[model samples]
Target chain A: MEIKENKKDAVLLLELKGRLDASTSPKFQKKILSVIEGGEKNLVIDFSDLDYISSAGLRVLLLGAKKLQSVDGKIVLACLADHVKEVFDIAGFSVIFPFYDATEDAIKSFE
Target chain B: MHPSELIETNLYREKERTLFYGFIWSAVFLLPKTVAVVLSNSVVLLADLLKSISKCIASLASWLSIRRVAKGKDFSYNFGYGKLENLTSLVLAGVLIISLLVIGYEVYHRFLHPEHIHDFGVWFGLLIVAAKFVIDVYFWHHDRHLAKIDNSPIMVSHWKFYRADAIANGVVILSLIISVVFKNISGIKYVDPIGSIIIAGFLLSSAYGIVSKSLYDLLDGTLEESLQLVILRELAAFFDDYKEFHGIRSRRSGSHLFIDIFLEFDNEKKMGEIYQTIEKIRRRIEKSIPGSNVTITPTRIPFV
Candidate 1:
């Protein structure tokens, strides 16, 4: 998991490159939480390079979204491949969350 | 000690510590044992060489177990990965027991047909004793510190094995001394094999004890006596406002606790009060059990 902060738009880009299964989800959560703590209100989780996600990964993402919401912060998913999107839909996460096709669109909507 | 602190802990740190220690010990004991066996044609040296290999395997297993145990909770394993530690402990025990049996069989064969041992066996046995003594003492001191601060029972069990290894090496030195001192005492050469079988039997028992306790914890066995009492006291105090409390059920998973209670509150009371009561009980349990992850289910008492 690679996390990069872009100060230009106050956007924190998280690049998840590998499988986020039960073994690795906690680490993913910790990294995201740190970004949240740094006052990055606009979070762009780039899944373009991500391969797989288990339920544990989904739960961590949900927790992240909930935390950001409490602070009036916005979290958006960018570049969702078809299979990954299916997981979100099956879990009814699609109803609870806002998603976008590209990073530019999610960032623009945040403004 | 603090829930917030536990929540913030990096599950990777302690795991790395376990792996580092296991790897260090494996390299230290295994390298010399293998080299000694080749340099000196000694049966006792060969036996100790086998023991070193077994120790290395146990250490490797401990490393893998540490990684698994450190994982946090998820939908796949709702309770968390703590029980993975217990599973690993059981597996380690099984492996040790199997090694002990194989070693014990060889010892029995050696005893049945006694033979002369190489002179180099004496020098190698002495060096092993010196090395084991230093390592054993170091492990003992560090293990006490780790045991006090960490909740890792498996690590402590491994430390215990190290202590036993030191003792076995001491016995090896004794047998070597007796064999070298007097020609008539060559009869005592049988002691080495006899002692190994005895040591193997002891290792089997210790491993069995560790495996059983780990399995018990994994199965949601009873809590420590003092902790159980504290839970019951808190429950009784929380529900005192109700008419009576019955059928209080509780089970423990790693650090998480789940409790269910049947309450006979006044049927005349408002629903809001019942909700408040349940909420209060939930908070109380959480407070009582430090680092507790709790879920409480309330059942209304049936009217007669």
Candidate 2:
């Protein structure tokens, strides 16, 4: 999977492309950890272009959420494809994360 | 021992009792099934006989392993004898494979020499198998309940084990009914062998589930994906207590969950206060993940 990063003021918006599966989750994890460690608290992950996400992908989201929550910040998701949203709901991740209809909404929610 | 410890120990004892009784039950049913096979040329009964034999060995091994663990066989080991249950399950998977092979042979052999399955023993074995089915249903439900309470791998394995047996028993009963009642119908000779092949298919599926699951846990793999998320969620909820998240290590031993987390706390905090924080985190994680033993360490160094 490819992660395109763009910062909007204090919010860190990441546009995910391709698939987030077992093979790609490790890189995603490292990126999340480093960004969170860099003191960037607000995380906006846009899943519009991402086609698939397995359980491995969910684990990384959790780790990122944990770090962000510890700092009184949050990770919000946006533009999730129908199937990817179904995956989140089925995995019981919908309650743990805040989802938005657009990237602007996700970043604005942090503001 | 403490009351909670005593309760946990009793749960394990109950687990052992369930498996021991199941072993005896499987052993007792073996004879009539075998006799039924010998009394008739029905390949389905032969396949069931093989399944009964396999169930006997599997349950016996399962019981023995739990018995060993309960009897303090883990004094020499650090993590205890929990993985022994997984090892035993892997062995039982092998037994299922053997049963499948025997069924394959019987099915192949019968296809070559078509024989009518209606005889004095064909209808006779039906009663024994029907009784066995009822008993299997009981154990199947019972094992699930026990496994949920104790989270023992043997109970989980036997639950699936009995489910497969019960389902195959259902198939065998149906095949026998067709064999006896439809014996006058032309081309009825193939039904008995077809039933044998179907039993082999169930055995194959059960073996795959057992072998894959047992091998993964026996190798000290991490917690499953959902469970891993559960830990992170708990940690996230208690995020403010610790200064830094160093690392987390977790694995499954049979049905037991072992999780260790490393965190950095402020050095200025009193020892008692830091311990209270750790205890709270540990308690929450353990509560979220049932049958888990969680340890939180205060350290700057990352530990996996």
DockQ of each: 0.01, 0.25
Each prediction's TM-score against the native? 0.60, 0.89
lDDT of 1 by residue, B1-304 (tens): 6876564354346644765686577667777776665654445555666666666776777777666555454568865466666676777787777777777777767877876555675677668657876786677666655544544556657667677776767766776666656536647667656656656655777687778777778877755544544554454355335554334445555434555555555678798997888788778767876545545444454212
Best by DockQ: 2
What CAPRI class is candidate 1? incorrect
lDDT of 1 by residue, A65-87 (tens): 65576577767888888988887
Please give the lDDT score at residue B51 for candidate 1. 63
> Could you say which candidate leads in TM-score?
2
Error of 1 at B172 (Å): 3.3
Per-candidate chain B TM: 0.77, 0.96
- Across A8-111, the per-residue lDDT of candidate 2 in tens digits comes to 99999999999998799889988998998899999899999999997678767866775676688888999998999987876667877999998998888965
What's the lDDT for residue B269 in model 2? 88
State, as a TM-score between 0 and 1, how close model 1 is to the true structure: 0.60
- Residue pairs of candidate 1 with colliding backbone atoms: none
